[model samples]
Target chain A: MADFSTDAARALAGPVWLSDRRAYAAAEFASMPPPDATDEEWRYSAIQEFDLSEFALLSDVRGAEATPSGMGDNVLGDAGAVIRTANGRISSIEVDDELAAAGVYVGPLAASGQGSAQLGAVSADATDYFTVLNDAFAVEPLLIHVPAGVVLRKPIVVTHHLSGNRGAAFPRLVVHVGADAQAEVLDYHTSAQGSLLACPVTELDVASAGRLSYLNVQQLGTETWQFSSHLARAERDASLTASTAAFGGGYARTRSDVRLVGRGANCDLLALYFGDGNQGLDFRTYQDHVAPDTTSNLLYKGVVSDAARSIYTGLIRVRPEARGTNAFQTNRNLKLGDKAWVESVPNLEIENNDVRCSHASAVGPVDTEQQFYLESRGVRSSEAERLIVAGFLEEVLESLPVAAVRETLRHQIDAKLSQHVEHVEHVELDELVENTELGGG
Target chain B: MSTLVIEGLRARVGGQDILKGVDLSMASGEVHAVMGPNGSGKSTLAYVLAGHPNFEVLGGSVRLDDLELLDLPAWERAQAGLFLAMQYPTEVPGVALRDLLRVSVSTSNDASEIEAAMRQEAKRIGFGEKFLERSLNVDLSGGEMKRNETLQLGVLRPRFAIIDEIDSGLDFDALRMVSARVEAATKEHNMGALVITHYSRVFEQLKPDTVHVFYGGRIQQTGGADLAQELEDTGYRRWSNENG
Candidate 1:
C-alpha cells in the first residue's frame, strides 16, 4: 500500500542511542524490505496478510479511549513498570524510577528520544520481511534495558492499543537483558472494534547468563488484521522463554524467530491461539542453533471454530557448528467445528549428525466418544464442546510464567469462542463450514 | 410397570451389523443382565440403546416408557431417563466432578435444591465432598474414576440404565460398593436397569431378576440369575453356534 519504511527509517536514524550499538541497528533495519509469501521462509504463512494496501499510515492523533482489559485492579504494575499506549501514541507511562536510578533503561522508544546507534549493533540479518518492514516503518518501540545482574521481582507490562479503520501502525520494541541479569517483559497488543491493521516487530537479546521471559498477548477485534514479527537472541548460558497467545484478529500472522548463538543456550517457545468465525491465524517459527550444546523446545496449540483456519510451520536448523543440539517441536489442534481446519509442518534440517530432534503435528475434532459421554451426563452438545475446548487450551495456558497474563489470555479465548460458537450451526457443521486441507509435504 | 423396552432392535457400526433384532425389557424393580462373549455385540447394544451416534439403528426401534428412544439426542435420551455406565468411561482432563454433575443437573431442568440433593446423593455413593470438587476424572486413578462414574449413575437415577461391564475393573470391595449403589439407585429409586456384563459376579451383587444370554449378536436364551451361573460354567462357545 504505502512505502513509509523509507520515511520511517529516516525518522528513526535521528533518534538518540544509549550507545553506538542501537544507532547501527537502526541503519540495518532501514535497508531491509518487507517479506512476501514468495520467499521460502514465508511459504506456509500468507504474507499477503501483511499487505496493508487499503490501510492508512495513521499519523493523526484521533481515536477513542482504550478501556483497561486486565482482570481487576491494575495488575500491570508488576510488569516491572507498566505503560499504556493507545492510537499508536503513548498515553501513560509507569517507570520504577529506582531502576532508572541504578542505570536501568525502562521507557518508551519515543520517550527516550535516544538509542538508535546502540540498538543498531545487535540487529540480526533482516531475518524475515516483516522484521524488515517493522524496522523500516517502526514507531514507539518499548525501550527496556536491565543493568548487569539485577533481578527485578516484578515484571514490566506494556499495553499497546490499535484503533481506526483502514489504518495501519507499525510497533517496534528493543529489549536488552544485561549479563547475569534476569527480567520479564509483558507485552499486550490490542485492537478496537473497527477494522485496523497492525504490523509490529520486537527485537530482544538475552546476554550471557541473563534470562529473558517475553510474553505477547494479541487480542485484536474481529475486524483488525495483524502482522507481528518477534526476533530473539540467546547467548552462552543464556535462556529465553517466550509465549504468544493469539485470541483476536480477523487475519493474523505471527513469526517467532529465535537465534541460539551462544554455547549451551536454551530457548523455550510456546504459543496458544483460538480462531473463531472466519479468522485465519498463522504462525511461522524458526529455531536457529548456531552453537554447540544448545537446547530448544516448542509447543503450539490452537482451537479452530466456525470456518476459521490456522497454519503452523516450525523449523529447527542445527548448523554444523551447533553440535549436540536437542530440539523438540509439537503442534496440536482441536477443531470445535467439523469445518474448522489446521495445518502444521515441523521441519528439521540437521547439518550435524550428533543432534537429537523430533517433531509432531496432529489436527482433529473433539472425540465423539468423549462428547457422547458428557452429553449422556446431561450436558448439551454446545456446553460440552465449550468444556472440551477450554480444557484443550488450558494445557498451554497453565504453563505461562505470569498469572495475570495467563488469566487474560484464557478470558480472551473464552470470549472469542463464545461469540463464534453462537453463529456456529451445530447440525449443519459439514455444510456451514468447509474444511480446508492443510500441510505441505 | 416402570419399563424400558427394546423391540426387534437392529444396530450397525461402521457398516457392520452388531445388535441383530435384539429384544429385551426391564421393569423398575428388576435388573436385567445381558451376558455375552467377546464380539457378541453386548456393548454395542448398550451404546445404541443410549443413542451413541457411532451406532446407527438399521431396523426396529427402542421405546422407554412408550417414548421413542431413537427420536432424541443423547442428552435428551438421558433427560428422558436413560443412563449408560460404560465399560471405559472417558476422562475429561481439567474438569471437576462436581462441576460436571452440576452442569448435568442444571441441563436436566433440576431445581437448585434438587441439584444440591443430587450432590448429596453422589456423596453418599462414596465420593467425598472434597473429591467432588476436583476436576472431572482428570488424572484420577482407574478405580477412583470408575467409582466416580458409579456415583454419577446413582445421582442421575435414570429410569432405564444400560450399565455395560460396570464390574470389569473393580476389586471385590469396589464391586460390592458399586452393586450397593446400583441397588439403592434402582430398588429404592424405582429405576429400570439393564446390566450388561460377561461375568455373573455383578449379578450376584446387584441381583438381576432376569438374565439373557446374548450370542452371535442376538439373545439366545432368557431366564433368571440361575441361567447366568449355568453359562458361567459352560462358556458361550457351544451355545454361540446353536444360537447362530
Candidate 2:
C-alpha cells in the first residue's frame, strides 16, 4: 500500500468532508492486511496472486488530450443524463434540462452540495479489502439523485474508463432514489489495453415505496483486474432490480449484498457472465431479508471456455422477523472447454419457519441432445454449439433490466464465441507449421 | 426421380444389435410403410439412416442418389436431403422454433420467405403462431409435438423423411390432421417417406404406395397398400420371431 498512502490520499483535491473521509479510510486501509485465499470471503478466488504493490494511483495531471474517446459512446438511444469519467476523474457530465428541472442531479458527489452525508450511507459496513481501498482512493465519486415522486422514463448512464499501464482507478458511485420515485441507471466500465486495476464501489438506496433499476456492465481489457462491490438497500414497499453483465477481465470478482430493511420490500438480482482465454470471473452474493413479508430472487448464468474459470457462492438469510419470506437462488454454468471450471454454492440460513426457499445449480457441457437436435436440422456442429451456448445465456440476458443494451451484450457474447473458434484455428495452424518444418528437416 | 438405397445395413446401440442387416430402397415421390411390432428395430433403421451418434453402424451404405450418407455426420446427412421426425422430440428450452427454422432453412438470408412458409405450414397443421415464438418443443403436448414435427417437415421439404412412430401419441383427429399434412407435403415436394408405425389407423389419411413387413431387423415381406390392411387384421403373428 506504499503508493496508496496517507500522503497520496491527502493530496487528492476535494471538499473538506471528502478529504477527512479519505484520510480516515487511508488509515484503516493501511492497518488492514491484504485478503488471502484462505479467508472464507476470498475462498476459491485469485486473491493470492493479487499484488497491491504492482499498481499506483492514476495521476490527476492527465489533460483532456490524454483522455481517449469512444469510452462513453451511449448505446442507449434514450438517456436522461450522461456522466463520463476517465481514470476515476470526471471529464464531462450533462443532465437533461427537463430532468434537472425535476430536481435530478448527476455530477461529482463533492460538488453536488449534498456532500459526504449519503456517500457511505449504504456501503459503510463493507469490510472487504478492495472496497476499503476504493473508499480510500476513489478520486471523483459521482452521485445520481432523483427527487420524490419524479419518474425518469429514460436511464442515467455513467461510463468509467481506465488507461495507462499499471494505473489503478477506484470509481465510486451512489444512486439515491427518493420516496415514491422511479429511475434506472446503467454503470459502464471499460479500459484500454494494459495491466490495470479497477476497484469500484456502488451504493444504491431506494426510499420507501421507491423503485430503482441498476445495471453494471463491465467490459474491461483482458489484461485488467477488477474487484467491484454493489451494496443495495430497499425500504418498505420499495422494489430494486440489480443486474450485471460481465464479459471481460483477466481476473474479475464482484461481491453484491442486498438488504431488504422494510416490510413488503423485494429485490431481484440477476447476472450474465461469459469468460474466455485465461480469465477468472468470480461472484459472491448475499440476500438479507430483515422485515416480514420481504422477498428476493437471484439468477446467475455463466459460460467458461478455453482455460477460463468462474465461481459463484450465494446465500439467502431470512431472519426471524422476516416471516412469510420467499427466496429463490439459481446458478447455472456451461463449460465449453475441457479445462474450464466452475464452482457453484447456494446456501440458505432461515431463522423463520414460515419462509419458502429453494436453490438450484447445474454445471456441465452443452447438452448432447440439444446439440443433436439442432444439428439434425442442418446446423453444423460448431454452429450448433454456438446456438446452444447463446440459448443457455439468453435466459438471464433477456431479463436484464436495461433493455437498450441487451442486444449489444448478446452480440458481444457471440463475438467471444467467434474469437474462441479463431483462437483454436490459430493454435492448429501453429501445430501444422511446426510439423511442416520438422518434416523438411 | 432420386433413390434412397440401404444395403446390408447392420447397426447396434449400447452393445445390442438392433438393426441386423436391413435392406430397403425407395424412389423419390414414393411412400414406403415399414410396419413392425415392438422391438422390431424399425426406429433403429430410421436413426441409422439419419446418422445418430449413439448407434454404431456395424456395416452399411446409405445413398441418397450419388451422396454417401453413412460417412457423413447427422447435419451433413440433413444437408444431403435427409430428415427424421423423431418420435419423442427433444425440448430446447431457450431456442425458439422460428429461430431454428430460420437457420435450418437452406436459403437462410431470405427471412421473409422462411417466415411466410413457416406460418402457412403452421396454419395447415393447426399450430398456433404463438408456438413459433416459444422455445422449441418445450412444454408442448404430445399432439402438439407431433404437429411441430409435421410443421418442420412441411417447411424443410427434404428429399427423404423418416417419420418414426408419429402416430403413437396422437389422438384420432390429430392423427388425421398430422398425417394429412405429411401426405400433402410428400406429394407437393416429391419427398421419399419411410413412415414407420405399428398400427394402420394413420394410413386412413396417408396412403402408402408400398408396405413392407419388418421383422428380425429385416424386411420379411413387401406388397401393395393391401399388405398394411392384412397385417392390421392378422396382428403380425406369422412374422413374430417366436412363431418363426
Candidate 3:
C-alpha cells in the first residue's frame, strides 16, 4: 500500500502549466477524508472495501515509445482522428489535415493553457475523493475541440491502454462542441492483465444548437478495478446522446450525470453491460432538467451470470422552473445463472406540475417461453440461450450512432457468451418441457 | 412411405387431462383435417406432437417413420423431421425473421442452400424483402404472422407438419393465400400434414384425404372430406353430446 501525499501528487503532475491546478486539487483531497458506505452516493456500493493506499499514482512516461499493440484490423477505419494513450500518457494522435485546418483540435490539455479551465470545471462542481485524486495526478489530459458551426463527417476515437501492476492510472478527457457544431466521439478503455486501479473523468460541453454523440467503452482486465465519472451539459436547443458498454473489471463503478441547462435541450442516455465470473458492475445516473422544455431519456440493460452481480440506480429531477419537461428512465436486467444477482432502482423527483416523468425497472431470468420457442425451431439449448441474451442486448446496441462500434460490441458479447457457457447451468430441457406441458393452453 | 403415427396418446396440462387416448396416422402425400368444437383439444394435440414443454404426454407413443419422438426434446424432434406451425407465434425481439429462418433451416439443410430457399419462400408467401429484415413476429398483422409461419414451413421443408388453427384470424384472401402456400410446399415435399381447423374453408383448398371429428380430448369419428363439411353445417353438437 502506497500513501498518496501532496508531494506525490505534484510529482505525478509532469507539465508545469498544470502544476497549480494539481496543487489546488491535492490540497482539497488532503483536507477531506475518503467517503465510506454511509454516504448516500456510496449506498449499495463497495466503497468500504476499496482502499486507495494499495495503489500508487502512475508516474510520467514522457518520450516512452510504448505504442498500442494488436489494435490492427479492429481500429475504426472511418474515424477522422484517432488518439492512443498508453499508461495515462499520449502516445500517438492522428488527425485529418482538412479537419485540423478547420479548427478541429485534438491534443494534450496542457497545450490548451488557460483555455483548459473547462477541464477542471467538471471535477470542481462535484468534487469526490476520486475526482480530486484524478485532478491532482492525471499525467496528460486529452482535449477535443470543434469550432462553431463545424460538422465533422467522421468520428473521433480515443483509446486508453493501461498496462502496469498495482499502479493507478488517472485519465481525463474534455470535449467542447461549439455553437451549432456537430461531432461524434468514442472513448475506449482497455488494460492488460494486472491488479491496477483506473480513475477516469470525462467532461462534455455542448453549446447552443450543437449536436454531440459520445460513446464510452470499458474493457479493463478482470483483475483491475475502475471508477469513472462522466459529466455532460447541453445548452439551448442542443442535443446530446451519451452511451456506455461496460464488459470488464473485477469491480467497476461508473457515475453519469447529464444536465439540460438551457431551454429545449434534449439528452439521451443508453448503456449495455454484461458481467461474468465474480465481477461486480455498478452504475449511478442523474438526469437534471434546469430549463423549460428540456427532455431526457435513459435506457440501460445488463446480464449477469456465474455469480456476477450488477447494481443500477437512476434519478430524474425536474426543477420548478423547468416546465413542460419530459423525462423517462428504464433499467432491465437478465440473470443467466441461479447465483447471479441484480438490483435496480429508478426514481423521479418532479418540482413542476406541467412536466411528464416516468421510470420503470425490471430484474428477472430469461423468459422460458422465448427459450422454448427457439428450441422448437431446432436451435440447440445453449445456442438458444445465447441468441436470447444477444437479442436482449441488441436493442441498446442498435441505438448507438456508430455502426462499426455496434458490430464490435456484438462480437465481444458473443466471445464472452462462448467463454462462459460452462459456468451457466444449462436449463434442463426435460424438466422445463414437463413443466411447460402442464401449463399449455 | 413414411408416416406420423399417434397411438392411444393421452396428455394433460396443469394436472388436468386434455387429450385422452388420441389415435391418428398420416402417411406422406396425405393431408388430414381434425375438426371439433372449441375445447376439443385440437391445439393440445398439436402442441404435444411438437414437444411443447407445457403439454405432458401421460401415456402414448408418437413416431415419425421409425423415429420414436415422444422421448426426444423439441429441438431433436424438429431435427427428426417434424414441424409445428404455431397458432400464435411468440414475438422475439431483436431477432430478425431472416436470421431466425437461417438458423431453423440450417438445422436440416446446408448453409449454402439457405438463401435461395428463403428468398423463394418469402416471395411465395407475398412477403417483401423488407419484411424479412424486421424482428420476428414484432408488430406483424395477423395475416402476416400466419403467412410467416407458412414461410417457415416452406423453408424448413420438414417431412411432417402440424398446422394448428392456421385459418383462425385470416381474412378470406389471406386464408386462401396461406393455404395455397402450405398446399404447394406440402405437395412439393410429399410431406404428411395434420391441419387443425373449425371451418371447412381451409379444407376446401387443402382437399384433405381424411377428416376426424374430435371431442372430449379424443377422436370421435373418422371419415372422408365430407365429415368436415358435415361438422361445419350441423356443428359439433352430435359429437359433443355423444362424448358427454
Report, to 2 decimal places, the DockQ of model 3: 0.64
Query: Model 1 residue A229 lDDT?
Result: 81
Clashing pairs in 2: none
For candidate 3, write residues A1-441 as lDDT tens digits: 685677776775456657777877888888988888898778877788888888877664553234333333445688889888888988889999988999898988778653556686655665688888888888888899998999988989898888767878989999999899999998889887878899999988899999999999888888888999888999999999989999999899998899999999999999999999889999999999999999999999999988898999999999999999999999999998789989898988999999989999999987877877777877767777888889999999999866567777887898889876644444456667778998894
Q: Where is the poorest 10-residue window by lDDT in model 1 chain A?
A: A432-441
The TM-scores, one per candidate, come to: 0.88, 0.94, 0.94
What are the lDDT scores of the predictions, listed in order? 0.77, 0.89, 0.85
lDDT of 3 by residue, B108-145 (tens): 66765787877888887787767778787889988888
Off by over 4 Å in 3: A14-17, A60-75, A422-441, B106-110
Model 1 lDDT tens row, A233-296? 8899998988899878888889888889999999999999988878889898889999999999
CAPRI grade, predicted model 3: medium
Q: What does candidate 3 score in Cα RMSD to the true structure?
A: 4.1
1 against 3, candidate with superior DockQ: 3
Model 1: residues with Cα > 4 Å off, grouped in runs: A1-8, A12-34, A48-56, A62-74, A77-80, A96-104, A109-123, A336-339, A425-441, B107-139
Please give fnat for model 2.
0.59
